[model samples]
Target: MLSAAAAADVRFYGGAPRRRRLRPRSCLASPPASGGGCSESESEKARSLLVERYQDGVSKRYTLDGNSKLQVHWERRESAVNTVEEEEDANSLIPQAVKDFVLPAGFPGSVSDDYLEYMLWQLPTNVTGWICHTLVTSTLLKAVGVGSFTGTSAAASAAAIRWVSKDGIGAFGRLFIGGRFGTLFDDDPKKWRMYADFIGSAGSIFELITPLYPGYFLPLASLGNLAKAIGRGFRDPSFRVIQNHFAKSGNLGEVAAKEEVWEVGAQLLGLSIGVLIMDTSGVKSSYSTLVLTWFSVRLLHLWFRYQSLSVLKFRTVNLKRARILVRSHVGHHVVPDYAACNKEENILTWERFLHPQISFGVPMEIMFDGEESNDMVDRLLKLYRNEKYILFVKPSGSRSAAFFVTFKEGATSMSVLRSLWQAHWLHKNLQRQDEVFTWVEESVLALEHGFTDFLKQMEIAGWDHNQIILKVPKEPVLVIEHPDQEV
Candidate 1:
């Protein structure tokens, strides 16, 4: 029933910890799709009792004691704890230095003007990215004879008309198509005027720009925006007490169906000028020109988005296009979604950890939207509805920060939250607030084995019998790794 978009995995790291030992817990698998909990099997129970003899770096043994209790013996902090507790503690990468905060510290930068100046620097960056991507893609396309110049006016004119169709149809589609669909929402009425005003502003901008193009493309562009505006009006209900307000009237819900008819009057005026320009130019579009136009559309779309902040995506999507190509990229699969990023729009651009696409041999840099972990967890929960998920926890310390988790896939982001919300895991496992301890990131132990080695290292590093909380990184790098691959 709630709006959906994010959250996956069971691994989570955060501030604070609980001093406790791990015990037999629920299996990693989600309850049988029936909204019911699943029980641990006998083999799973027996697996818990087997004595684990560590052979890598400082070797040790993990075994259940005579009283049927888990016990651990390591070089430092020897105490028996279950797999789950160890997995959760692996999250802690204690910061070496805690930074202080005070006034005029609204931004992390030394001065507010510095941040503004940095943003202004991005305009050149956008132009650069657009140039590079266009060149590379054009080169590749040409190599394959994708869009070559062919001198055939009859075919060229048809190509031009065919090429302009999506945008042209979309322009008209926005109004009636948008208006008809807008009625589905039953939002507050007072907010309608605000949305209407925003739409009008967007429509005005489009109208101003439309005249630059020819008859077919210009009106379609403007109309498309107006249709979008009409749709927006229905989505945003008006809360204004003045029922007499014209915008709240929702006239026929058409793009031209504004409270004041003059709104459309201005757009039509622009459209007329565009029609005149198309007739005067009388230029015919050749096949080459049509192909160029198509590529330009895709280029502008991606560049415009890159010009903005970060884009969001889902885990299940099968996107073949990679938006970025970082030189030393750390790619992975269990990435955060748009909802997790708390972005207003659900932009479906594959924001690969690929860093940025190289333009002029320099890494493309854009604005970084590293929303804090609290905000991330808050917004991400809306995406999961009675569905079980998993997560991989990558600490935010250094470029080579060690991957922290016991499971091959890592810990679940929701499991930690679910425990708190459901009020079950901590109490059941005896995690007291006073007993938790954290391992500083300065101490990245080199273990020999894989998941088992991580648990042993935590105990060997003196985090034994202590539930360490791994604080979620503000900017978590979403890169999946191989089971044996070093992170």
Candidate 2:
């Protein structure tokens, strides 16, 4: 019964089952005597049993005791060669330190969906822009007479004075430009970025020509420095605002760190190239060569800048984007989304001359010239009594008009958007025979009828209602008592 039980228990777990099981032999109950013929034969039997089990893919072993025990061991086979190959392929050749310096920690996972595309264009734009900027710096320094070392104290003093005065003018220039355009930068960063780049290139041109006018070096170099400073003022803050748009994961710090790394890398490369160019005989000495190279590079820089801005699909509604949506809806009866409007937007604001210019949050005093016409103001107020904003339109040119929107206190983003749509409707339908008041009246009526449905269509088209990019002026809100309203 014991032998039958042992044979029944001898089961294979991994390999195929055998039809017959071997019964425990008497050799399993006793230890084999050392150096004897019986012992040798028993050892051969044990070896043959293990070989058979291994061949069947189920390995087992036995020990000699009165009550013997059986042991079974199984291990999953590992394909180490394939694993090693996979590891090698996944690894990078860049040193860990360099990777840490160049990339944000937790990278692709840490950034927004638009970050990679932004950087793809930004890399070439920064590289080429820095190269041109470096060349401009080299030429400007040469024009300023500080390009090379000098031995004379008077010459050194003059160079020092020139550099200091030029920088002083630039510092003031930056302050003025930054203050003047700060609001516009936040409202329309994309258009301003293009403008800033072009202005910076103009500064480069100014600096490049300074060598020709040796007698007027101070004024020309200062002007160049001033223009470049204005460009920097606008470009830096505009870039910051644009970067903020890409931090969907709230990882602005990581995004900015990686951006700084790219900027520094591009600047270093530009410096290296500038050194090589300077080392070439007659490159810096010849103004024509420098001008030719700078102009060609400046063109490339502008093109890259355009390409970079083109890839950015901002969901926010700025004036240009709002105009696209309104025009599409009003003219074609089709609502376009943020992406479509962004693609249709002109980075240079060329459409500024084509359509009516819209200005938001104009002061009440300025709009009505200090309440000189109370009756007119009251009539206008009653016209838009249902709305939170007031619109005023006037002919700006022979072909174009200017639409000024002044918001009352407690106005919201929706109010501003509604006013924009109404203003656009007025722009499309206003005729020579239509009085400004009558046309505005018709626009208000249309707004009352269609604005809610317009908003629904906008929502359907993927417009972000919460993010209106229009700038609200800090001027005092309008307040005039109406005879018909309760105090």
Question: For each candidate, what TM-score against the reference?
Answer: 0.21, 0.62
Off by over 4 Å in 2: 1-158, 279-285, 350-354, 357-377, 392-404, 431-439, 483-487
- RMSD to truth, every model: 24.1, 31.7
Clashing pairs in 2: none
Q: What is candidate 2's lDDT per residue for 1-487, written digit by digit as tens?
A: 1222323222221112223344444443321233222255444443211111221122223222222222111211123754564465459686544444445544668668888788679989977875565456545565567545443345544565666678778767677766454456666788888888988888877788877888898898998999998888888989998999988899999999999999999999999988898777777678788778778878998999999999899988876787788778877777887777888888876533536566665533234432333345546766777776788777545566677776665566677778878878888887853366777788889998888888888889988678876644433243333344212
Q: Which regions of candidate 1 fall more than 4 Å away from where they truly are?
A: 1-263, 281-392, 395-487
Residue 409 CA displacement from its true place in model 2, Å: 3.1
Predicted candidate 1 versus true structure: per-residue lDDT over 4-110, tens digit per residue: 10111112232112122223323222223444322434224422211112211121123222333333222211236434434544664532121111112223464
